[model samples]
Target chain A: MASSSQIDLSGTTYCVLTGASQGIGRAIAAQVSKMLGPNSVMLLLARNKEQLSQTASLCESKNVKVFYESIDLSKASLLEMNFALNKSLEGRRVTDFSTSLIFHNVGSLGNLAVDTARMQDVPELREYYDLNVFNVIALNTQFLKLFEEVEDRVVIVNITSLCAIKPMSGMAYYCSGKAAREMYFKVLAEEKKHIRVLNYSPGPVETSMIDYVLAETVNKNLRDVFNSFKNQGTLLKPEMTARKCVKVLLNSKFSPGEHVDYFDDE
Target chain B: MASSSQIDLSGTTYCVLTGASQGIGRAIAAQVSKMLGPNSVMLLLARNKEQLSQTASLCESKNVKVFYESIDLSKASLLEMNFALNKSLEGRRVTDFSTSLIFHNVGSLGNLAVDTARMQDVPELREYYDLNVFNVIALNTQFLKLFEEVEDRVVIVNITSLCAIKPMSGMAYYCSGKAAREMYFKVLAEEKKHIRVLNYSPGPVETSMIDYVLAETVNKNLRDVFNSFKNQGTLLKPEMTARKCVKVLLNSKFSPGEHVDYFDDE
Candidate 1:
């Protein structure tokens, strides 16, 4: 409820957020709910039921109708069903909404290794693409359908990584997946003028995924580089990052024909 | 052999091209052979044996070692075999020289509308992704393995479309495939610093594919737009485009981590 009156989310009756269980997703959900009143409905999706419940409870004070689905989006069929169910619950037919905003914040960093040999051996390379690349494409397909039907100002915010822009030795697969998703959204934005698609590279954030990567990698050089980035004051907190994302989402300044990097603003 | 002295094909040792039977593929094969000289070798891959043989004959100038494999690159096993064969033919160990250069120029286009109602009904869509997206990823994976073993520079050129960059009706599936491939290469370029990758967008060329698209769709706007581009004297001939491509390949100025669009230069 912090300065929630500054932004108007009442018009945004329905907001869909993926990976809404914790970290940035949860923060975005909370911020969005506070902006909108109780009449507005927020749909949260994640794989963990307990975590999703916790997220819903955190946003309960906003008095908004909060809903969640504990489902893995990597499974295309399950995602399709969940999408259908969410539409049905809102009492709005799948094709009716004019303005729909989708935040694709779900991602996983599989492994970190500077050596190409070791990096390729990791099983998570393919899994990283499955979750980051395939899911992004599939979900975009689903959302585009609804956007076309509505033909309103649809905004798609894909949370990308700084590694996507700059070359890094470790986290090759994760970087590749992020870079692919970034360009996918850029192409989507260019081709479809109706939708405001932004591939925002949020640099680095203090998230559990980062901790996992730091713990798994044995390279001291990579760790030192990561630590330097943190010390440089480039790393953003989840709430602060979410605030910037919301500003961009609500702002009409962007032309929707290019990729927006969060650090580029600074 | 017109103005052959202006071009240098002597140092070019090994070359690999996909979809090398007909259309731009065949044209590139023939031109690349002439540019690379008699000692160099060309590995051509396509699905049509008869067409491959015919193209091989046209590309057999200057005693260039012409090798054609009528195997579909969509088959992962066949792709692996082709890579192994190329490495053996080069007389270098399997890990000696990474894939020197790869032209991911294979794709398919069908007159299909974006059927949001039945998103899965687009059968041709899968083939588009298989040829255009998945095959590119597979080839890059193989190339990355080779890159680690060799000290030489590797280049990957992905031939994408103008439709991938712009909006077009009735070609959503085709655009999606091309867009995905472009992004994949873009990310690969970012991830692997040693390999020079070019996500080249060729805009529109005078190919049979363009004729087919024009025949099926009512949108003459693209035709008119292309015609104007031609009127402006910028529509590149196949040979001219191929020569420009070879120039980029041979020149050291164009390095790793850059994307070049033909239209952008215009």
Candidate 2:
């Protein structure tokens, strides 16, 4: 008989990535599509549809499917977000995907200054919690709900910051939010064995947040801190940090629960 | 000369304590009134008006002024809570009091079993955060606002638990909430040098929370853990724990931003 080959590539991987519009999130989107190969679907969530669409196009692959959704993860409740997800996946039959990955890259470094900034700003602090912590818990729980039953592969990658462990002078909201999110993930790590949770610190990168601080921060200490780091050229490239994150995600032998840093990996 | 018996007791000390309806909270109320002397005012807060009134009656002192407010700290915002506080102190210009203290003794160990409980229970989880974390930040900020201008004596006592540092498998909300509150206080301690913030772990004590856990918990492991500690008589009396907390609060030489444990103190 003449040699013949057939390959069925359908519903192999499904990923939900938050804050995938730009910066480290965009870099991760581009790199993850290349790493996961074909027959996969990646859901890019962001509020800026234009930037999200650009990220989707930048991460385009022949066999891998990518779609960006314009949804404010910070404001949406678990029910609303879940409804959105189900609607997005409607009739796609993506449930049979072997590996479900959730990357929480959404964060807000709001008012990066020590001058007159106070935690008493309840609305702003709550907003930080909603974006950096609550959304992740909601989406991670949703993914665990889907994958926990079938005993399939599940992974959670939280883009945590060094501020989580080291408290900043003025960034109380950001620091505590990160700490709370990491603690939640730690508890999840203990609760679920089949699921792997990694709190990854993407090191200092040249993002808009840093640029904003460099340009507009009024706190002399914070300005000097950011300017010093930038002057020293110590900030890692986003692509390099994404590569480190992907490597950590693929390394199965490493134990979960603890935090991993990109600089340490280097 | 004849001794003057008319004691001019005015503007000596003011204290705000949450969860003061019963248990260690009531014990702390009793001891704090005695420690802050006769001119002290203790504003007790709780949801149950009857229980709070009863606790106030039980803590009646000839020296200190004791009053209870029927307000659920979890439901009220910082603004509303501050209004209630000012209303409670109506006509009593106690702002000039030499010492201002805030005791955060409120926390919820809701639905202690992880069986089907998810942080997706946004309302309940938000309640946990409000009662355990944000309220403390708000109240502390208020106190700091009152005392930060001058180098006055201000102390914040957060009634923490081992679960703050030791994450429980089933009590993710409780553990992470405590961690968030502690981190917030840690940040406050660093930002303001005039304030002393202590995350005081009262140790395992006999309280309604334990009784409820012992009575209505589905998690066998958690039940066994609580029962074993109870059976071994390792649990300290609420009064003893309260005394230890008061001792730590009175020690001015001790630095701030420290996690004080009752057992460790002994």
Best by DockQ: 2
Candidate 1 lDDT tens digits, B70-170: 67765555346446555536665533232356677777774444332123432343445556666556665665565445523456678777655454545
lDDT of 2 by residue, B19-97 (tens): 9888888888877777665566778898988888877776667656777888877767777767756765556665556
RMSD (Å) per prediction: 5.6, 6.6
Per-candidate TM-score, first chain only?
A: 0.85, 0.88
On lDDT, the candidate that comes out on top is 2
In model 2 chain A, where is the ten-residue run with the lowest total lDDT?
Answer: A1-10
What DockQ, on C-alphas, does every prediction get?
0.19, 0.38
Model 1 CA lDDT for position B100: 56
Grade the docking of candidate 1.
Answer: incorrect
Tens-place lDDT per residue, model 1, A1-266, is 11111223555356678899998888888777776644556677789999999999877654466778777766556356446445634666644333466778888865564453223232244455557766656666766665555644466778877655554555555655565566556555544556666666665777787667677765565677777766787767888878777776666456653556665563
Candidate 2 is graded, for docking, as acceptable
Residue A175 of candidate 1: its Cα lDDT?
Answer: 57
The ten-residue window of minimal lDDT in model 2 chain B covers B1-10
